[model samples]
Target chain A: MRGITIGQYYQADSPLHLLDPRVKLLCTLAYIIILFFADNPYAYGLATIFAFAMVMISTVPVRMILRGMRAVLFLALITVLFNLFLTPGDVLVEFWIFTITRQGAQTAAMMALRLFLLVLASSVMTLTTTPNKLTDALERGMRPLKIFRVPVHEIAMMMSIALRFIPILSEETEKIMNAQMARGAAFDEGNVLKRAKSLIPLLVPLFVSSFRRAGDLALAMEARCYHGGKGRTRLHPLRYATRDVIAYLVFAAFLAGMIVVIRLF
Target chain B: MKLILDHVTHIYDPHTPHARTALRDVSLQIGEGSFIGLIGHTGSGKSTLIQHLNGLLKPTEGSVYADGKDIADAEYNRRALRGRVGLVFQYPEHQLFEADVFKDVCFGPKNLGLTQKETELRAYEALQQVGLEPEVYDQSPFDLSGGQKRRVAIAGVLAMRPEVLILDEPTAGLDPGGSREILSLIASLQKERGMTVILVSHSMEDVAAYADRIIVMNGGGVTMDGTPAEVFAQADALKEIGLSVPAATEVCRRLYAAGIPVRPDVTTAEEACEEICGCFLR
Candidate 1:
């Protein structure tokens, strides 16, 4: 159960970790948007090169990034298979009800590549940026939302808290599952409905404990004079360094290059 | 049932970057119907060892034999073995999920494939064994106090009618009164039912008071296995491993160091009181 790595920040000292989280977050968003716009092979190749360079400069292991790919592998495969079989073009191979077309194969491969790159690029942002810093940056970036009374700080706090509790809740679930299993509760043995029913024994305790933990956290926060984000100060205020500006310029250049490549191709 | 661990070794997340050896090449034998106390500090593998008793975890190396049969064998029915050897994990109440206490207690026997009537009867007997009243059995388990909820959780395991009962820190997070009550209840259950009881605890006093045999673990290996008196006699050795003898045993050790003719093996408060009284009378 411990193999889960999604949304987990990998701690490493590199330019990526040093960049301002807000800049990184915006750059990631731009990268994902550019991925959809890059349709041709040359544009896709340029985008892939840019992603690979970012990953190398970040000093995060390629294997770690690939591990994050496991989460989206099924979705990538489904998109590829659907496009391969369903899209119409010059038929390269024909079967009873399925046709392997030239355009279909190219589209499937390109779609799979787009999906993979999107996941990888977003994972880079999450891997290098600490949740606390990410939330701080998010709260700062959304300050304009205060004009609409959106409670930006509260939303950031909720997101950060949810991220922090993911691992804790997973560990609790494993413990409860093992405890129930010791009582001869076969979670994997039953049919679909039976499996769903077995999960009740696991979920009820998890909800109860999570609520208890939430209560304790609230009390602790209040003890420290936490009364929402009003007039709250940060220990490490989000600041843009020299490297962060360089990173933003590089990301903007990469996006412009991808757009130019797509237009020319 | 007689349980034997033959050079058991357990490694968590094996061949991974986060791999850890939780249990070393440790071998031990637990006879049938013996009340054994397994004591260790937080990471000393006491919890890992007990999980192997009922096949909740298979040893990474070596074999665990129950009733002279290797449970790790492919043909062994682990489900039936789990029912025969119930394991109550630490803070077991966290596993309770039924609408009411009675249904929660009935879960174990129902899983064991007992009929509805048999399941209810076993649940009633188990709840009664844990000193829970019948009226509270109809209430939501979440409505009960912490101690009561824990008892209901224990009754859930007890309903399986395990031949060997293993409780990991059963009295953890309980008040003094509650701890004492639960300890006494376990003692009575062991005596009355003649079931093999293995208690994993951190409190030296509780183990000293109730356990006939004490197994001390340190650094994923068994360091000491003997009667309470013999184990507590090595107070300095246990202290070196971040464990302490019972308060009464510590007192006896102090008296012995002060040139008084007191037995250092005295473990319980009652025994220390009698020894000190005898010394004063002399």
Candidate 2:
């Protein structure tokens, strides 16, 4: 559980870290969409540089960034493999009704690079922004949906609570696992069926307690007179600043560079 | 069973940015049938140290020896070791998950592969030992009161019939009366059944009142280890580590300074009372 590097906000003082999370959220989406349009070798190279520069600008350790890549490695590998053998063209190697084509190799490499770059660009955002700020941005970004009676505030509140509970629930899980292990509950020793059976001892309590915690949390919130989003004020409302404007300008410059490189080169 | 931590060192999330040295090169020996109170401030490696005793955690650098065998070794039967050296985690009630209280207690011995009759017998005895009534056995563990749930959780470990029972803050989050009840129950288990107990707690008086030996931990190492009187004697040093002498021991100190000819190292209220009585009688 500790090895998981995705969605963990790394604390660092950098321009990217200081940028408004809504801007970061929107820019990340734009970058992914832009990546899909980057076709030629030089365009891919520029996109790779953009992803690398984002990681550097965020001041998040490259090692931690690479650790996040490991999580999507299987997905990347599958994409590469499918493109490698399934995309038919001029055959480069053939065996047992399977043919590796010249275009297939190129497509496979591009697909791998694109998948990795996609994850890298997103993780840079996640690693820079704290979960609270991310959810705050999410709530603000979805503010328009309140017109449709979408329960925007409730959804955001739930997201924030869920984000808060991940680490807590994981810690609880470890304690529960240790507790059961001390009872001679062999979690690792059993066959697939038996191991799954063993988890009942661990999971049932966790589920029960999580619900209990959620109930308690609701009571605590209500005790403070939380009556949904109506007439509610944020502790720290989101606002655009000079740095956010500079970030938007930087993003626009990057987009122009991306479009120019892709269109001209 | 004799338990020995041979220069154990535990590092959590080693070689990572979040790495922490939870336990340093600390060594200790716990003999059979001894009630040893392991006291320390929060995050002072108290929890990390007890986890090593039963092979629940492998030391990053050292070995945990139980009955002259290295538990971390590939040859050892860790399953059996865990059964004999049961560790009840802090807030153990969070681990209870069976359909009923009786079945939850039986989970431990059942894991040990005891016969159905034996498991049920141990569960019944364990529930009785924790002072729970027969009527609650059929009810879900979740339906019980906080103190009752805690009892059921403790009974879960006790049902395993471990020779060495290690409870991490057994009385935490309980009312004072509930705390006293649980502590007395533990004391009785040590006295009546001769079970070796290593109680991990933050309460100074709890240890002084019950433990034969007190082990003080600070910054992932054993800062002090001695009898209750010997450890309490270093009250100033204990306070430096964010711990304090028990309330009674502090009162005893004040009494000594106030020109009373009472023992300076008095730990428990009962002990201080005896000393004051003796001084007055003299």
Which candidate tops TM-score? 1
Q: Distance (Å) between predicted and true CA of A60, model 1?
A: 3.1
DockQ, candidate 2, vs. native dimer: 0.80
Candidate 1 lDDT over residue span B122-143, tens digit each = 9999999999988999999989
Write one digit per residue (lDDT tens) for candidate 2, span B72-105: 9998989899888888877755688989999999
Model 1 misplacement above 4 A: A81-106
DockQ (C-alpha) of model 1? 0.78
Could you give the C-alpha RMSD of every candidate to the true structure, in order shown? 2.1, 2.2
- TM-score of candidate 1 versus the correct structure, residues matched by position: 0.95
Instruction: Output the number of the DockQ-best candidate.
Output: 2
Candidate 1 backbone overlaps, count:
0
Q: What's the lDDT of the predicted structure labeled candidate 2?
A: 0.90
TM-score of each: 0.95, 0.94
